[model samples]
Target: MDEAGLSRRGLLGLAIGAGAAGLAVGAGAGTAAGVAVGRAREREDAESAYAFFGAHQAGITTPVQDHLHFAAFDMMARTTRDDLVSLLQDWSYAASRMTQGLEVSATGAVDGSPEAPPDDTGEALGLPASGLTITFGFGPTLFETVEGEDRYAIAALRPRALERLPAFLGDDLDPAASGGDLCIQVCADDPQVAVHAIRNLSRIAFGRARIRWSQLGFGRTSRTTAAQSTPRNLFGYKDGTANILANDAASLDEHVWVAASDEPAWLAGGTYLVARKVAMLIETWDRVRLSEQDAIIGRSKGEGAPLSGGTEYTEPDFATTDANGAPAIDPNSHVRLAHPEHNGGIRILRRGYNYVDGNNELGRLAAGLFFLSFQRTPESFIRLQRSLSTDLMAEYIRHVGSGVWAIPPGARDGSFVGAGLFA
Candidate 1:
């Protein structure tokens, strides 16, 4: 089976042939090594848990987890503002308990009567907390109705940056998977734990809210902490190599955390989240030549070094040239275009994941990167994506889903999330 079981090339072909069906490929034999190393690190993290009530949301600055279950929900018709507030209170209480590896309620998982349904689902009964984090967000449409009417009397409280993202170039966004009035991001080292969190939260929202759409993802494509080795995407590329680290307090404050002076009082410590479901055309990408792939990404495939030269962390010499005198890094390469140097130093905290959803009707693999990022404002991502529209890599991917949410500051003890807005 060669050193990599199926060779890199062979795996790519198989991924496309089998419709990408949740296949995880490695660079030759290195994949097994990487998996072994990753699991060891995850084991340590699984044993470590974070506080649910804090200054900022846990998942934003918290160390990235191995699994994600993100869901967006819409308030039910005739739902009152008080109903929403109560739901958030319930959610916050449950979240706090779950993070500590406890049952949803004090009754315990199996302590309830035999005829009654348990408050907490038993799927994760024996599991550790697994470093789970649950973050809540309010969508643009959450502040107002489809007709632009104020629903909760908090229309004026909406941050100007919370508006729906303007349509950008090359966008083929799907309405079914797009906007939502609210979003919940559940992350954990264990897939079952993450899923369990979402399942219980959805159950609590039964009458007042309904899930609009949801996504399940594994093998996080980005690392929030610097100690992690950069993870790879389905396209066999190192993703988020230059991503902002959680330890960079200066960058986080300037680029990620919302300053009190930036907007409305309630949103002072909050940030904005932008999500896009970027579908990678594995069939086409697998057919491309290695040299072209490297040129398109502006990085060496094996080492992930900038094409301009040096190691992976080496600053790209965008000005330098090869013997022929042409620009060493392609102008439209993913790196050159998205680099902070080219974007006024604007940076976003990325926490994306690789996703494979079986096959499409055409018999091709339906797989892609579930793009997730947080910034001080929505403009950061909009500006960056606008510039990236000229990228040569656009041809190999399609943006099928999109959403923008206003992430509120974390809830303090004795209060629910978004409590300030209601005040």
Candidate 2:
């Protein structure tokens, strides 16, 4: 431990409170040789990097990455308020470096002492940035536990809308995975890169916080930009056909980003994230007839166009009629139920993924859609979810796990995530 009683790694975390690359900003790394070495290391790994410090976090509005490692954490019992602050500081510093394609510390994996453990886990050595982004959030429990204990004594600062999500219809929710004190959403083009980020961040949390539940997701289920083609979910249907795009600033302001006028001023620039682990009964759904499936989803399986429509992007004609004079789009179809038109123009930005977690004892695949959506207020998601209670697709799926977290605004150059809460 250091003079301040901080461990070796913890001190390194504090030292880089500013940018890790700022090591040479003032003294130029002590010598020209040292400066060249630092630059060389940066150039080797800084490919496809995203800025970690921003007005809003990177992972949310940034083009969705191909892989995700979403982990929920609970603060360890009896930890002090200072412990929480320091942990966030350490996490922020480490995250800033990792997002820039640097190791968790200046002296990384191999450079540490032979007798002691390395600062970094070493799995990501020599790897490019891979467009990595790490987003952190504060779950409702972080402020006040279910039993009403304000462990950290910041309960008053908790936003009024940051309470636990209410139970919805058709929920088979697992208590073990439903709630957490904190959450981190890590995403990258390379699956290893995504996992590496969460693993390292968890290590940094150490005694202060422990992961409550985590999910590994592959094959992005939603597209965030026009450049990305619509991806299929485990149900084999093109999903997120009309999702809020990253470039729609007007829509983002209206539906996704929380406005300054909102309550709990600390969360003004941030948004709420709602996650649902919707398990698709793959074996049972496979036996479904094609025409019936089309009617269920209200879209053609091949083209993904609305049954009442022109093309994939054509607006759905909810009022259109069939030859027999019935609505072309089924009244209870997934598309119609989830559409913004039917829900008082409410919309959310989705960044979901498909996952297959091996088979169950009955020889059935344990696979599902790890649904994620960002909304300006928790009510936006709550209202939409309630509207989908009557959706026909509910027959083949079960919501096995769920959570809601208030994502704090991104850190400043020398600040930590959630620092505003303490301020």
Candidate 3:
């Protein structure tokens, strides 16, 4: 293999083994080396991540779909303020550099077991050991950037601003769902390195920018969580149910991977979509009685199972008839409305997160979803949103925010897009 490929393979090997020595020391050292070599691989992997952001300058493009949500409030201390600002600058610089020459690859796990591997492609692969996910917020800096660029460029943070739930909901925040104003979700592959990279980036940003607060998230995969499934939001429903599957190579090509088109030769192998929505009113939703809510969502709120009753992965029997001979799932039901049988079915992939807004005038009742989905075209997503907009859930949910973005494909070492596109 070429030097760049060789280095990536070596790094993957080290990363797969970094957990054995524990994440702190070995992963940290590896991350430092990765950063050192990152500059050289800029045109390959890092740059692609950056280009993904550059192309989709208007939306949130977290490295991973399953972000560990965290939210926090600003501290009153001057020292805290100074520290935050410095951290923001560091974060911006490191992330910008990391994305400069991004490359990605999939490797067999260390044990060589038949178990499936996590999808570590695109920006998700760049995450450090400790970082589970990252989320940017809407602050003065973010707003300024958005207004200046006519797009949302700010990234999210984690660990949340407050440990205790805010007073808005009248009860303590759900520990798992509580998030930071800004969050950096670490990678399961190397949590320690991810954590250090995030911290370093935060420090850089703080030193140079006027950031207020940020947080961190550290957690294992669903295989390790108490539920033995992916973490659920405050509503007790599983999130990221429609993520691109790992084992199906053909499906990956059809759904997740987009081939280059003629429009933007520079954007060959790039994909684009928009994902934005307001948080749901969970507290009020909770009061509505379980059956009613289930009907509204067309799934078990606790397990995210289809209303007809099956595991998350099982397809709902939309054609099954009830005792009365009518369709078991009503035609106007949330699920039915959102997922009709015809027109190729509800095809968009949803990779969403939850958010809590304390600034709302309605006294905050466990806000709704930070709705996000991915698809080849906006039309299908638009159809789903339109259905939701007119559905029964519309009474409680609202679309307060939105953004569009593109996800570009990976590149090999030293081979930039324009070099081939404009050559």
Candidate 4:
């Protein structure tokens, strides 16, 4: 049958049949059993060109400032769906074994890319990002199972975020229309480490499945700058000055948490949104003076606080009038343009990382953010960027990369990638 015409139900049926046969080997048993099977497969089908053994060990590491971010996706032949599912089941089992005993935070979801009635279970899977650093992986149901000869996609994100988890996991954001199947982020002190992590993950992913496409990202600096350090956008003087903060649990309940009234029972424990952008341009940015730069950004150079006068994270009254009764914060200022609320209100949960690259021909360094955000909707995030693109900072920064992903509800055992897509 044509790959596109094959349905997920058909693929699942195939996987169930194959899974029963592989039971003599117990392919779907558990992580421990899965690892043993995975090792056997690696040895039997071992191709020297694809070093599956070494690739497996490259998945874990201690906290480092610079770490690699890698992603890969593939299409499965209808006939091979069962074998593929068995293979992935084993791979996940083996991988978890290798990284055993480490404080790893993970979430798995099926493809619920298309909208469905909310699952009404009150049980909450309190996967909070407070104080604990963690990375997330997203596997669509179709991709997870050995199904039809259909194209299945998987997206994994590393680098855990305590402050940014709400936005990254929130459901209001849609990623299918945005063109990305997987997303991964990690924090490494060194750039090389980040690249190494990404490359290794790609190897494992490609080694097991067929990879259609991939990409990587690096950050400009390891630390957040003093001036542009709002919770959402960077400091370019007035950047993200008008952001909202879930100051109290009540507010957090209102903005960050998904309403129990709107989602599925399984989805009850989930937050959904995946906001991502690829920002570039720094060479031209460095030449501007501190004073001029501050004026353009609408804040002091040393601190990211508002230009209307206040400390970092403090509120700025945008409505205040100047001597001539004009606006105290210039309407065109970066912050003013991005957020005019002035109380340091209107916040977003930012979970982003940086990337770097070199052009051998030009002999120059290319770097910027692998920007990701999770908000309730596209409206607030869109408004902020729209302000930036038309304002003064636009002259220095250009959005070279962009995508949006929908982070669906997590999954139970045996059900593979994006079960939610059809759920």
Candidate maximizing TM-score: 1
Which tens-of-lDDT digit does each residue in 1-423 have in candidate 4? 222112122433454455566676665654344345444433332221111122111111111223344443443444253444554444434233222311111322222333642221111111111111113233333334323223432212111211122232112323321333344343333333334334433444444444433345433222222333343233333233333332334543444444446433322323434434444456666778876677577677677766677786676667877688977667777666656363234445444555555542565446555555544433446555644554776665545444433343333444432344334
Model 2, position 303: C-alpha lDDT score: 96
214 Cα displacement, candidate 2 (Å): 0.2
Number of colliding residue pairs in model 1: 1
Better TM-score candidate (1, 2): 1
| TM-score (C-alpha, index-matched) for candidate 3 | 0.51
- Residue-by-residue lDDT tens digits, candidate 1, 1-423: 122322232443443444333244433344444445444544564477888998998999888888899999999988888888999999999999898777899876799888888898888776668899999999988899779978778888888878888888878999999989999999987787889999999999999999999998988888888799989898888888888998899999999999988888888788999999999999999999999999999999889899999988888899989889999899999999999899999999999998889999999999999999999999999989998989999999999999999999989888988898998
Q: What is the TM-score of each candidate against the true structure?
A: 0.90, 0.89, 0.51, 0.54
CA lDDT, candidate 4, residue 344? 35
Ranking by TM-score: 1, 2, 4, 3
Clashes of each: 1, 0, 78, 75
Once superposed on the true structure, which residue ranges of model 1 sit more than 4 Å away at CA?
1-46
What is the overall TM-score of model 1 with all chains considered together?
0.90
The residue-by-residue lDDT of candidate 2 on 1-423, one tens digit each, is: 112221122333443433344554654333444334444544533556999998899899888888899999999998999999999999999999998878999888989899988999988876678789999999999999989999998999998998888889889999897889999999987777789889999998999999999999998988999999999998889998999999999999999888899878888789999999999999989999999999999999999999998999999999999999999999999999989899999999999999888998999999999999999988998998899899999999999999999999888999999888999
- 2 or 4, greater by lDDT: 2
The order by descending lDDT is 2, 1, 3, 4
| Count of clashes in candidate 2 | 0
**Residue 333's lDDT in candidate 2:** 97
- Assess candidate 4 and give its TM-score to the true structure: 0.54
